[model samples]
Target: MSSIRLIVSDLDGTLLSEDNRLNDSVIDAVRRFRASGGLFTIATGRFGPSARPIVDRLDIDIPYILCNGCVIADRDKIWEMAQLTLEEIAPFLREADQAGVTVLLFGEDGIRTLRSTPETAYFEQREGLPCVPLNPGDEAWTERPVQKVVLIGDMSQIRPLWDRCRSGYAREYAAVQSEDHFFEIIPARQSKGEALKKLMAHLGVAPSEVMSIGNQLNDLEMIEEAGIGVAVANSHDELIRHASYVCRNGYGEGVVEAMERFAAIGAGSKGGNTYVD
Candidate 1:
């Protein structure tokens, strides 16, 4: 029998379809898994503004790793969270601005941007929330520190800064790219891997009993940390190369193939709607 009890997956390029909607096929797959006494949830870089609606729509009853695992939450309770203080990222903000990177700040409450930009609007539309403009000098949210920060801009502009920040800021954050256009900064002390470990302990499961799948650089640690790690076909080369298994399919279809391969999750596990090459 498969030791897998919990299955956590990332959103965006892994679980959601190319159109960015959660489709029936993936929903059906998850429902079947749940009905079979399996636990399923999401581990996404997104927070309440974005991740929660999907969780509700899918009726996911399990805790989700959010903000790159800076917080692990369910509807009523936030089981875990890590705050990034102004002192911690103050230096990076200056460097990012100097490097021509636009910033987006995330907190438990909402998202804020240094100023409105096409990037901010795009992210806002995707998240189904307004990206509020930031006025750091204002005293309104001084005590409300952020949990994660996104630095984004042109690939040429941000990549070199990312390379520098990756090493120079290593001690303060776990910097990784969620997409080619964006770099996410999560506190070094926090990660989806650590959150999964905590959840496993709480459920009385071992490292050998969990499975995880994701596509972005943020997903790297969690994928490496899982007992059975899977990657979508569309994942970055770094993750795809490191994954225990790479799905022939991508997105929601990839998720289905992965569950079938690792846990034989559904009765007709060998069959699904065709979306693979």
Candidate 2:
């Protein structure tokens, strides 16, 4: 697949509609893209279980980037993982709890939390994974390391903590705000760009042969790294400034527009629906 075009897209606010569902057009577009010998996969902040359903729905054959790139997996197995120890997370749990932010822990064991909050409830509903109650003092996290630690809740509750984590934990962690209220904490070395490079090395593809789309801070590095970086109409201002092209549409429509742009570019045409940054 070294000679094939590799396309990696973000899920929420890029591939999914504003309503958080994949539209029929995207499904067909992905199928057509793969049918045309393109490698299609999604790089998302979601864990495998959360991202797997869509991967299965699209019947994607390529390995997908997950957990904000902390994990890489395909339908049958996990290809790579970067983990954090409970000792590393203990400081976070204490600080976030004291700061009144809700923390969601991701591990090989699934999502574990101190208690179910409205934010966690929304997460449960979205990810289709229940929060296994494991308080700060619980023994469950003591022996095992986690893949990622995410903070989700109101902005007022998460922002100051985000700032603190950025300043105080910069050396030990990579803190990214995936959404306004969703702050993800991973090992300092992990990111979608690095993971994409790893995948490329594994498959013998180069950065110049890959195309990626995203709309948030977490997607920034990969957007800057890919040969063709795309930002949707509703993407963060910062991302738009760095993107190689901006899609005329938003969400799933933007996804369709991007693949169309890819098709156009493949056919030796640069259409007006996408603009150079």
Candidate 3:
């Protein structure tokens, strides 16, 4: 029997294709993995609502890590959540607004923004979730629990913001460049890796029994946390450096490759020269 009891993947650039749809092969692989009594889930920078469709499509019954690990939930219950108070995120929000960067707040209920831009519109269209207008003065909105904050802009705009966050808020929050155009902020010490640990404990699974696959910097921690860390061929250089196994394929194809190599029953052999230090 395979030692991998669980498989965790990242969504946008790992499991899903560029168009944000799952390949039939990837779906089939996931179902097969589950059928073999192996658990599977996803860890992503997306909010719960945005990720729900994928979860349902995959028929995931286990808790999924969301908002880069700030929230952990299944279809019916939320097992863990780390939130940022308005005061904690207000500074960045004001800066983003003044800098003409699109700011999105992922809350417990849904996503909200002070204003919408073409960028946000594209995000809404892609994620299939609307960004409700945030009422700054409304006590109800102000007091809502915020899971994370996302700043969307070109590299020029995002670079400065990322630098500022790293310089100033490094001790208080985790600032990760999830995408070339996106910088995400969550509470300090919170990460997909940390949440994976929590999930493993909840499931009574050992670290050595888990495999994690991802393609971005935001996925670095979880990749490190897993016993078997895989990075797709198109992954960021930094992520590849940390991954124990680097796939010859990218996107969903890479996921399938990893499963066949590590998680499949009676799996044997490295299949090729896929591992790198």
Which candidate tops TM-score? 3
Q: Please say which candidate is ahead in TM-score: 2 or 3.
A: 3
Which is the winner by lDDT between candidate 2 and candidate 3?
A: 3
Between which residue pairs do clashes occur in model 1? Answer: none
**Model 3's lDDT to the true fold?**
0.84
Q: Write the per-residue lDDT of candidate 1 for residues 161-271, one digit (tens) a residue.
A: 666655754356676688767778777778878888887777777777778999888888898888989999999999998899999999888998888778667544333
Count of backbone clashes for each model?
0, 0, 0
- Tens digit per residue, CA lDDT, model 3, 1-277: 7899999999998998766777777877888889899999999999877888889888999899999998899999888888886664566677777788998888877889878789889988888788987665665655666898888887687677666655654357777879768888888899999999999999999989999999999999999999999999889999999999999999888998999999864332332221110
Listed in order, each prediction's TM-score against the native is 0.88, 0.88, 0.88
Off by over 4 Å in 3: 135-143, 165-171, 265-277
Which residue ranges in model 1 land beyond 4 Å of their true spot? 136-143, 162-171, 267-277
- lDDT values, one for every candidate: 0.79, 0.80, 0.84
Please, what are the lDDT tens digits per residue for candidate 2 over residues 60-115? Answer: 88799999989999999999888877664577576776666787888887888866
Each prediction's Cα RMSD? 3.9, 5.5, 5.5
- Candidate scoring better on TM-score of 1 and 3: 3
